[model samples]
Target: MEIFLQQLINGVTLGSIYGLIAIGYTMVFGIIGMVNFAHGDVFMVSTFIALIAFLALTQILGATSLPFCFIAVLIGAMVLTSLWSYMIERLAYRRLRGSFRLAPLISAIGMSIFLSNLVYVLQGPRNKSMPPLFNDVIQVTQGGGYDVTLSVKQILIVAVTALLLAGFWLLVQKTSLGRAQRACEQDSRMAALLGIDVDRTISLTFVIGAALAAVAGVLYMLYYGVVNSSDGFIPGVKAFTAAVLGGIGSLPGAVLGGLLIGLIETFWSAYFSSDYKDVAAFSILAVTLIFMPSGLFGRPDVEKV
Candidate 1:
């Protein structure tokens, strides 16, 4: 039970990160009805940007305060990643719009390859390590030769996830921009006919999705203390799995799915075999997809002929 609790705590922290990235996947798919094959690469790029920002803050400017350095890196990465996201939409995706669906998908996959290789070329296919932040751990309980511990980083992850989720819900649910996005999601042609600016809404969607991915990237780097050019694929796929499992078009469902995937991976690693943890997650994803294609919160779309 102690180990269970410990794994649960760790799972929630990891799940929060997955939830952050999964929200990006869900948001993009919800609005555009396309799986962003390059979304994960965008996340990888943001992490590199965050790493560089941290170096600039700590090494160049001698920022010794962990909190200040973290804040600056997070904000800097968010801004730059949003710009990257915007450029991607404009350069790679915008022209493909209104074309055959496969055209955009192929473009997204090509962009993903381009980004991974671009980073590999620039940063040289090596793992970049950052100074560890939030090393403090508190033992919540001591039991039969096993101790349950909670780290400061875990607290920060959970808290930040909660805050971001709340802020985003407000943004999507209560704002005029959100209404416009919703309208576009429902019907882009009608949205444009109603003067909602479909193109701008799509761009904003990409920007917002990238900003969220930036947050996930920063937090992921902080948690792991190391990153590589190829770091985006697994997490990105897992996040997509989370989006699909929870209902690709549902925000709340994405969060739920992330949490479940995290828990499943952690518990399987703790109780069973670590090597098969990913297999378990993938198996669940496959099973869910086969059995419940619409997902828990997703509804099928039926268009009139």
Candidate 2:
């Protein structure tokens, strides 16, 4: 019971990160019907941005307030990563929107490669480590010769995720922007006919998605205390699986999938071999695709005559 509780805590924290990244995938696909394969790399880039921002705050500026520094780093990473995603949408994806579907997919792959290599060149191949910030743990329970503990970082990760999701959910459900996004999701051409700026709406979707990815990146770095250029690929893939498993175009579904994946990974690692954790997560993806391709909450795609 103690082990189960501990793994549950760990799983929720990890799943929150994955859900943040997965929301990016689902939002983009929801809006434009294309996967931003470079998204994971964008998350990767945000970690670097966060790293630099945190360093600039502490090492260069001599700032000492941990809370203030974390806030600044998060805002900086979100803004810059949003800008990067915006440019990618404008320059790399905008022009290709009317082209063949394969063109965009291929372009996305190229962008992913470019971002990874660019980071590799700029940051080098070495793993970047940060000074640990939240090492304190709270004992949740103690019994049966075992103790269940939760770290400050875990609490922060879960809290931040819940808060962000609440804000995000409101943004999507209550705001005009959300309505516009829904319009575009239904039919971009029809939305354009209604005087809605399809391009701007789509661009904002990318921006929002990138901002979420940035948050995930920062939290991930804080949780793990280290990062590498190659770090994006696996997490990105897992997040994508989450998106797909939950129904790629459904935002709430993405989060649900992420939590499930996180729980699966942690529990599997705890009870089973650590090596097959990835296999277990991916297997969920395969099973979901084979038996329920539309995902748990995703609507079936309707073909227009």
Candidate 3:
């Protein structure tokens, strides 16, 4: 029971990171019906951006407040990463929108490769490490010769994720922009006909997705204390799996899927072989695809006559 409790805390913390990235995947798919394969790399870029911002804050500006530095880095990463994704949408995806389906997919793959290689060339293939923060812990329970504890970082990750999700939900449900996004998701042509500016809506969708991914990147760096140029692929793939498992077009489903994946990986490593943790998570994806293709919250597509 103690082991289970400890793994649960770790799983939820990891899952929060995956959930944030998964939101990006679901949002892009919901709006344009294309997986932004470059999203994970966008996340990778955000981490580097955060790293640079942190260095500038500490080394260059001599900032003492960790909280202020973290906030500045988070905002900087979000704004810059959003700009990067907006440009990617314009340069790589926008023109391919009307082309064949595979065209955009291939373009996304190419962009992913380009991003990974670009980061490798610029940042090198080595892992970048940071001084750890928020190391304090709260003892949850003591029993059965074991102590279950929760770290401050875990608390912050969960709290921030909840707040972001609430704000994002409100953005999607109660605003004119949300209405426009919904209209685009239903029918871009119809939305355009109604003077909705489909192009701008799509661009904003990419921007929003990238911004969320940026938050995930920052949180991930804080949790793990290290990052690499190639870090994006695995997490990106896992988040993509989460998106698919939860029903790609459903926002809440994406988050739920993320939590499930996180818990599965953590527990599998705790009880089973750690070498197969990735396998365990992927197995869930495969099973979901085989039995529940529409996912837990996703609606099946209805063909228009």
Candidate 4:
């Protein structure tokens, strides 16, 4: 039972990260109907940004205050990445609007390849080691000291996830901007007729999604302690799966899906064989499609011919 509980906690932590990235993918898909193949690479860029910030801070400040350095790195990464998100939308995605659906998707794929190659050229093809932001010791007193441990990385993951979730909830539930966003998603033409700027709302959606991706990226780097340019692919695909599993376009769905996937992956690895983890997740997904294609919270769209 103790082992089960430990695995459960591990699953939730990992799931939260997946959920964060998934929300971005889902939101973009919901609002703009774009899959954003490059979303994962955006997370990769954020990780590199955080790493670069830490290195620069340590060099200039002599590493006197490690905690302060962490805060600075996170803040710097968020700011620049948020800007990067805005720019990508403005420069690339914005142009493809109203074009053939395949056009945007192909463009997104092109962007992904371009960004990955750019990072490879700039940082080299090898994985880079991330600096430790949390050095505190956490000793679990349960399970007979099976040597269970926690660290600042876990706390950062949870705290940052919580902050982003709360902010998202407030944005969707309480803000006029969010209302405009929902209007756009429900029907772009109607939203445009209602005086909402569809283009601007779409832009905001990408910015918010990218910013969340950046946050997830930073957390991932802290958790794993290393990152490579190709890091985003699997997680990005998994996050998209989580979004669909929870119910595409549903805010709460993203969170629920993320946690569920996280738990399944962790426990499957712990109790079963690690090699079967992907198989288990995909199997569940296939079953879900067969049994509940709309997902846990997805609402069906009705169209009149």
After superposition on all C-alphas, the RMSD of every candidate to the true structure, in Å, is 1.2, 1.0, 1.1, 2.0
Extract clashing residue pairs from model 3. Answer: none
**Winning model by lDDT:** 2
For model 3, how does the per-residue alpha-carbon lDDT over 1-305 read when each residue is reduced to its tens digit? 99999999999999989999999999899888898999989999999988989999999999999999989998999999999999999999999987988999899999999998998999898999999999999999965699999999999989988988899999999999989998999889999999999999999999889999999999998999899999998899889889988998999999998998899899999999999999988888898888988888888866689
Q: Please, what are the lDDT tens digits per residue for candidate 4 over residues 1-305?
A: 66786787688889999999888888898988788888888888888998888888888767768778767877788788878778878877898988998988898888888888889999999989965657685866544747566666686788889988999889987999999999998999999998999998998888788778877877887888899988877787778788889988887898899999999999999999999898878887787767876788877646589
Among all windows of 10 consecutive residues in model 3, the one with the lowest summed lDDT is 294-303
Model 3 vs. true fold: TM: 0.98
Rank by lDDT, descending? 2, 3, 1, 4
* Candidate lDDT values, in order: 0.90, 0.94, 0.91, 0.84
Steric collisions counted per model:
0, 0, 0, 0
Cα error, residue 84 of model 3, in Å, equals 1.0
After superposition, which runs of candidate 1 have C-alpha atoms over 4 Å from their true positions? 303-305
For residue 160, what is the lDDT in candidate 3? 86
Per-residue alpha-carbon lDDT of candidate 1 for residues 165-246, written as tens digits (9 for 90 to 100): 8998999999999999888888889999989988899999999889889999998988998999999888888889999999
TM-scores of the candidates are 0.97, 0.98, 0.98, 0.92
Look at candidate 4 and tell me the lDDT of residue 193: 95
Candidate 1 weakest ten by summed lDDT:
294-303
Off by over 4 Å in 2: none
Report the candidate with higher lDDT, 1 versus 3.
3
